[model samples]
Target: MQLIAHRGLVRSAPENTLAAFADALSCGFHGLETDVRLSADGEAVLFHDRTVATGVPVAAVTRAELSHLAGYIVPTLAEALDAFPEAFWNIEVKAPAAVAAVQTELKPRIERQRLLLTSLRHDIMLSMAEALEADTGFIVWHRPAALNSLLYAAMPHAHLRTLVWYYESIDLTLLQQANALGFRNYVFGAQTDHEHRLCEEFALHGLITDHPEFVGLTVTPPLQ
Candidate 1:
């Protein structure tokens, strides 16, 4: 089971910031996962949520102005890449344009084995898969009802080899069914030791977690 650093081991530092991501890398995390959204100027920035929650709107600010916000500064995908050179990244593009922008900025730096682009939107994911020529793209499907439809649509294609469905709880039955239907990667449950065992049992390629160090410690028992 591969342990992914969710938002850069959010427990230790600010979520999705360069400081937090650097900590995850120093802590020996296998991979780093972060969300990407488009800025006001159409730059691919590393951030989650559809909009800024409490303070000034990110979309209203320039990249330089966004860097001066309270807790976390909106970092461009390129900034993130420059910050962490050796770490592998799993970037979740929030929408269509964000995906395109990320592809534009990060394409040259993305060596085959180091990056995995994922999204919740089916068409966006399919389009990204096609554009990036990736062998397998991770799609985040939340509701159970959407799974059948998504799989149905993706069946005709060869590039999409993985499906990452999020849920409040794990239904092994559903997981089995999904795999039976040809879904390659099934990411479920919380970040826990028990979940690690479950991931191992299912032969999953990766496991998402809020804390990357926990996964590194629990799954592989770090090298001395």
Candidate 2:
């Protein structure tokens, strides 16, 4: 199973910062996943939330200006690519428009093979899939909801892949369902023997957790 460091090995460093990504690389995590949002000033910054008390969106500030913020400076997508040239990037674009901006920045520096473009928005995913060629893969971040809803519209398509970001428990049936469809599975810190059993049963493509060292490591039983 591929181990993807959620938020760039968040255990060692601040989440989604250059420091976190560097730590993930040093520790040998092959793929790094992070969220992107636009700052008020039109700069694309690496951040997860919609807004903070400062009343400013991440995109509003440039990397240089955001460096002084106490929370964490919103980094441009470009900065991340520069920081880790060889790493596989799982970038979740918060807004559909961000995809175009990201592509514009990424195209000149590296080829599309190293990146996986993804979004929860089906329209955005479709737009990106349409804009880019077949080689550039698009993944859909999945959530639990009514099966017939608008969000699940992309699940039936072959090109659309599913990435589970968060979960309270490991439901083997769900993982099996995902596997049956040939979609990749991701779980957050299922660092236990039981979870491993589920992972093994489903043949997960990848696992995400704050602790990278425990990945693929056997989870020993607790004291009786």
Candidate 3:
């Protein structure tokens, strides 16, 4: 199983910042998962919330304005790709407006195989899959919805390539079902040591966690 850094090793640095991403990679995380939103100018920026710390809507302000308000400039999607050219990316489009911009920025620079585009909005995920060859995954925050997604992905004709579930929503039954169906399962918010162990025991395809080191250390067992 791969250990993915959620928001780029957020436990080590500010979430979605370059510093966090660098820390994750340096510590040997297999991939990076981040949230993307469009600035006022339509640039794709790394951010998790619709608003900044001061409650300014990111879409309503230019990246520069948002940066000023936050005291540090947020990394752009392009910047992240440039800085970490070898890293696998799981880019989550946080809003419909960001879909096109994220695709445009990534299409030319990265290969489809190295990326996984996901979102809570099914329409946006489908649109991105149509626009790019990269794999598409769904982010399910609720248990019932997650079960539905799992069942759907089991269909031979289903286009879903991955299932990203909220960590708390997953259980042994769901894991077994996903494994039985051959769907690549990933979980987010894996913050505890026990959760990391569960990921290994289940052989999940990946885990999204703020503390990558905790999981990264166990990605490969010590050589005998």
1-224: candidate 2 lDDT, tens digit per residue: 77677788665557888988877777777788888776656666787766555766545656565656536665678888888888888777878647767767766654544676666665776666556542222342444553235225556455556555454644566666666666666665566666655655667676666665456432223246
RMSD of each: 4.1, 5.6, 4.7
- Cα-based TM-score, every candidate: 0.81, 0.75, 0.87
| Model 2 residue 34 CA deviation in Å | 0.9
What's the candidate order when arranged by decreasing TM-score?
Answer: 3, 1, 2
lDDT of every model, 2 decimals: 0.69, 0.64, 0.79
| lDDT of each residue in 1-224, candidate 1, tens digit only | 56677788665567788877876766777778888877778777777766565666656666666666635576788888887777778888787667768778766765634776777777877776667765445555455554576577677667676776563544566667767876667474466767666666766667777645345453333346
Best by lDDT: 3
- Candidate 3: TM-score? 0.87
User: How should the candidates be ordered by lDDT, best one leading?
Assistant: 3, 1, 2
Give candidate 1's TM-score.
0.81
For model 1, which pairs clash? none
